[model samples]
Target: MTMQTRVNPEVRPGTPHQMGAHFDGEGTNFAVFSAHGTRVDLCLFTPDGETETARVPLPERSGDTWHGYVPGLAPGTLYGFRVDGPYTPDRGHRFNPNKLLLDPYTREMAGGFIRHRALYGYKVGNAGADMSYDGQDSAPYVPKSVISDPETFPLDATRLRRDWSETLIYEAHVKGATMRHPDVPKEARGTYDGMASDAMLDHLTRLGVTAVELLPVHALKSEDALLSRSLVNYWGYNTVGFFAPEPRYFGPEGVAGFRRMVDRFHAAGIEVLLDVVYNHSAEGDHLGPTLSFRGLDNASYYRLAAGEPRYYVNDTGTGNTLNVSHPQVLRLVMDSLRFWVQAMGVDGFRFDLATTVAREAHGFDRSGGFLDALRQDPVLAGVKLIAEPWDIGPGGYQLGQFPPEFAEWNDKYRDTVRRFWRRDRHAAQDLGSALLGTAELFDKRGRRAWSSVNYAASHDGYTLADCAAYTERHNHANGEGNRDGHHANYSENFGVEGRTDDPAILAARQQRVRNLLATVFVSQGVPMILCGDEGGNTQDGNNNAYCQDNPTTWIDWDRMDEGLIAFTAACSALRRAHPVLRQTTFLHGAERTADGLRDVEWLDFDHRPADWSDPALGRICLHLRGSGESATGNASTDEVFLAFNNTPEAAILTLPKQGKGLWQHEIDTARDAQASVSVEGTQVEVAPHSLCVFVCAGETP
Candidate 1:
């Protein structure tokens, strides 16, 4: 039964207690925070969201919030806001009453925002630019915010609260993951329904990823430049509305589709983490279009320059930065996060350019208000909070500086693992530090090893296939003169640059793939993988395919490297089965007991004690066995030894002795698919640029 009341004209002044459009069964309350607005008009839309039906002025103002109640409006009602305030741009105010702004707290937005010149606050070709006024109606070309009672979904967020130590994040785009899959119905392809299908759920469950960190699904504005180039924002980093889910990813039932998607993921014992961009909105720089935040309260919502109020602080390098310093702006962010978790059923969030979120007046304060609020928030403190941890601003490469509540995306681990697998000199030290969870960075402040979220590949960089098959970033299709992505990719092609016909090069590239996969899974800390990297996804060496939404970015399910996929699966299974690999506490050099074997022992290729400072050594031999408390409070696990060979030729590695039990080899990157591990006498020959794993029972190496 519909829980909405019939439409009527019994309008009343409402309290400014809550933000956004909230329907309370009898009436709908509309509230928005605009600190500098003189007047706020609530523009109601037709059923099709095309024509403006009525314009009601909000009659109450408490603090910076403008609020009112439309006594008979129901949950399905569509609306937008137009706030009247100062129009001058020199002093950091860009308000235009003609342009309808989206409610920052809008739960569901109707997408089909037709790009038109009238949507801009300033006239298109006027020399006076932003100074000139435009009186055109923007309702004809913009999306309308919908009134939604987010209490429509089931509230069972108890089961999905996975600890950081057990999280295996699978970073993927909603459309790119299952758009071409044969099992997903043709009509449901690339929609939220498709991602929630049995095939997608089965794949994630079988692959053993505990969580799926989806690329941005928030409603965003397609950049005009990319539109002119006939490309869309595949990454969805250009966010316009935080609370609203992207319409393109939805099916016939609108918000219900996303709700079902999250429900299904949780049902499969997998968590869902959204890649959110709250640092800035879709509004571009000085010459950018005036969207929601820019048109509503630019001076309050954005961080204007202290010296020059008209200019913005370009900390995010995304043209503008959200001023989280403002109380109302901070409230918007906190409310948005809580809404996504409690109302929308998402388990966690991965903040993109997260350093910008914690920035204060002095610049990048660890104890900033944003982090302080998040730490104290009961709803958010328990969920997974991950940060990209860096931006393009000055002093923005903050790797291990986040609060204890958050786990940072470890790029150092990615680079060091790549260099170690590629046999760079002096890489053993870096690899060893990463394999131990970067104790120097995270061991302080009562943080655990899981604070460093390790990964070999991510969505922003080259896939594992590209990392082994291409040295240079071939991003020619990004329409930016092949200069859009990173230049130093830490990638290498064995004998060919892109693709080759040589069997030896192909074999070598496959070995490198297995090596990288084994590195992430075998190393400590939470491991993340790019979605199709397990299936050999490639963008023709395109490291940055942010704008290419076609096959260049989509995962080609048919062309998967079956052998590499099997290897990755085995690695994931090994990581899950062996508690010794996923350690919660730091590995001390001491043994588990006084006279027992060590928890972790470092050795050279000759089975001797390792000289960590030696620059000539490039191999990593680590024997790991846990006896202390882990993340789950249980420890005693199997003893496992891992050997990584980074040299140019085979090396004879001396083996540790056991009473009567033999060391059973588990993995060798040099071996073929499903290769049996035959016992080699007393010494094992490790091939060049490969990794090997052997399970031992009461052994010392």
Candidate 2:
């Protein structure tokens, strides 16, 4: 490799205070952290990033970082790093000057990885394995990072920051949400613009979702194993660049397209929440290819095993866990989060495998450094914080275990709701606890019921529409011979496994879906709905479709279940309108006042108190009073009563005389979107296998 045609771009010593490629109007200042690297070269590529035109070494070494300033570099300048150091495997240094490495803080990139043998640092198919070094030039296959000036982007000033108690989250993939949307323009489909189009916004706004919790948007690359199968990592969990938005999701305007999408969502009064995966990065462990973090500073960026430097701490189920215990590594995660909130105009983040972020040298700690840092951070603490609350590490199932500042995805809520709807014996007790926001689990430490982020379906599991349609997972299309997905679904099919022409079976399945939706919306917590589940989105029982990026993951707008969609919207509206449904305080069976009814009371046969110990119990009623704001915050006082029956025989529900207002039927899962008149009397017959929601002082439209 000769540099005979290289041109001087007026390079100078650069500051290492900022940790990314920041381009001012005059030039770009490049800075990267590499505690153990001996030398770092900044390789500049041509406009198209196909050829390297020049190689400039960073002239400054501040502390452990290497930096340089180019006098005439532009914001879109394409470049990558080649840090020269010892290629030691046992000591956890995989740096190779031959391979081009991306900056961990890059905001945009020009290309993606092309499958080539030279991308890997170690020689392939050699007996020496990772212990052997290969000096093949990987500039042609690896992408170059684009220099983007964060100060140049203008964020919308009207971004919405909804209260966590009132927050209703819609978990969606940007591509799958609009790819099959017929009303969205053909060219705009699957792009950021399509998600912000009138068709998408109108639907989301009408549904009354306070925020759209988008799946991973961090720039990622497909796994080598997947690439071998001609498949891609559709979920984007394998993050290659933390700051850059995924290049595939961008429109012709590039990074600007993502900003526009956020602006439009904010304009519609809907918050944007990003499902971030910071526990790990795209660069896998010892045998994986040397990418951004691995190539730049493997030992500093990753959590190598205490005794074995060549191995990694696989706490994230990925190849390696990010070493957030390291201050610099922690800074990268925090900086990326702030960039999304301040620069990208996102409102919050739902951290994937959040337990790892708080994992220290020993175990998960509530007062861990990362958690404490967020608690003290002025920028990060004010925004909404949601955690997946668990990882593949030991003692990782931490539902309802996060600090008071965070709302956690309550798998207990998910499982109990599914079991109750499926009429599992002895599920009534767990159902009652879940309906009251699992207070037994999360009520202490000043945390409210809203700390539970409740949902029945998510992107990683079977869709809501498929929950009652198939008993077993059908993930053959995922190319894993159907062995990749979960084995125990806790799901049930009425009679047939996949599809049936029997009207009775179909109606039963539909009612079950409605039942689950009712439970989620009315429960005392922050409700989250899987994006397309409201429209009866089905993945054909593919519980784990993280790799299938085709129509299987995309929302089928043409054949959408309109009835279920309308029902879901109605449920969302009711939840938004009624304060009793979303309680900041845990629900107990005590009256709000001396004369008023209970904040939440369970009723059995003939208005008798529920016998929770009854093993065969299949029916119950939740009488919720107009308890407002937990005697703390300011909110509305609205009353509601929900009756659910899983029995085959109809039960006559006696509505209590609350002495507040008249009772009216707002929802009946047995009927199709009907508004019944306000009942003058107290008695109402609840059909078998159905859910009923009644409101006070209500009239039929």
Candidate 3:
């Protein structure tokens, strides 16, 4: 079963074109990039990868790449790189030949990362800090890269390539979404195979989500600080290997399990999108351990400070920022993206801390090198590209600044919708803008309504259930004294904090959750629903549960709210049934020449034109008509009317008159059922802190 060959294979000069270990039937070629290293050695290991068997120096060097070939070595060969270079931390060169470095282009990894003092390049308690070099061999503590053949696991499923206008994204974690499912096999739970099981597929298909945006699946290492506290980076923001999939999520078939999962998802008509974190690595600050990147030409791989090279430019809140501006680093990212699409069969990507990748020396740029490369890439241009759009660096919040090719996560929409439901002052005006795709911010640059990815709750914040049941964050379990997450959550506790048994308070909380879900589905954008939000899942008010991998973060399938799930499904079906709701064109209240009807209309409670300057207004009505220039090509003459009331008192709203059609009640957040009564009068009373929807019935006006 083992693929290990003789202890010492015949070595030959290999070409430097390929970056990583490539198996070409007869032998395997090993290549790695190291700009400042004087020598590069390829270390071969046993089948278990616990001990080194041979060390052969690369016989050739072309430009910055060192390469060599072994005549008899085949796939599954365990190997790693050791580069010899200057060890000057102050000048930003932290290469140590003693440390075993992982190949940046590794497709699979062997063994596991063992935390030890030998992993660090410098002595633990030396007075010179990183300047003092340590000569300990780290092969026993580090993982070895495995030579893999892509042809072994071929992906034949066709890409779904769902259009942006019709996408309803369900953000989920690979393990959290499947770990608690009762029907999944015991051994498959929390693995890639579990996500593709029949139970999971049925749940997602029944919910009507077009795509599932998975959290990071890239290989990562937990921080030393979190390991000391018995916690981990559950969200996977800390990436260690871009090419290798996380070994922890692998099923019985290893890397092939990921391919099968993607194929199954595609067969079920659900696209898969990965949330990628290319901004930084798992290595921490200047006092951090010398991982792969730090040990292999640190000055070329990372962005060092201008005058003081000992420290790194903390553009990302993480310890070191990747120098994506560098040509080789940029190539590494692009290669990884293409490999995922062509070999792995992913439909799209969601970039975390995206601003850090698009930033130049000056500041965040829409046409920066990284963004420009993506814009012109033949393989990437057609795929879905989304950006988190912000970081903690100087001038990092670059919302609505990306090119037309990319959609952005709109935090403005989230805040506005939350504040409106919480009855914040002047929130009505902003709420209207949010429902209209925030045209003031994204209408320019030829961007369509789908460019705004609207969501009320995401992974980094409180869940929708917690947003209605708790005002203060209960993150004491995160071990940060509850000071880690956002303080102003724009949430309301109804009557009591955390959980309450009061019937009235519980009713209020349920209504608020329904209202929020309704708002997201009816809005003109690509809507994203947080996983388990539809089932009324809560993290015990732990808004910053990034490190909790227990029941607190996992979705409890047995305790789901069935009524809320049905309501969420109904909202999604409504959006899919109406083309006017998911238009690619932005509506600006402009009259359509085809029917002489305005695309959108705003009104007050008395059916008069809404006063834009009214700060005390808590009620607003929207009338949406199909645009003649709708890009979907299925736009009909049908119309929709929405009424939102955040005040403490009920209001009588007048419905717009249609010539030959009558309005039918479609949705009411105050109740669970789809109220399908035909309107008999022009005036309808809307309850306080609720929303109502009416659709045109019979004929067109």
Q: Each model's TM-score, in the order given?
A: 0.95, 0.96, 0.97
lDDT of 2 by residue, 649-700 (tens): 9989898774646887888988767565687688988899898999877433
- RMSD of candidate 3 to the true fold? 2.3
Rank order by TM-score, top first? Answer: 3, 2, 1
The TM-score obtained by model 1 is 0.95
Q: Write the residue-wise lDDT of candidate 1 on 357-474 in tens digits.
A: 9888888988999999988998886888899999887788899999887888999999999988887778888999999898888887888888888998898889999999998898
Better of 1 and 3 by TM-score: 3
lDDT of 3 by residue, 51-137 (tens): 688888999999998899998798888898888889889889988998898988898898777888888999988897778898888
- Candidate 2 residue pairs that clash: none
Steric collisions counted per model = 0, 0, 0
Candidate 1 has its poorest 10 consecutive residues by lDDT at 1-10
What is the C-alpha local distance difference test score of each model?
A: 0.84, 0.86, 0.88
Each candidate: RMSD: 3.3, 2.2, 2.3
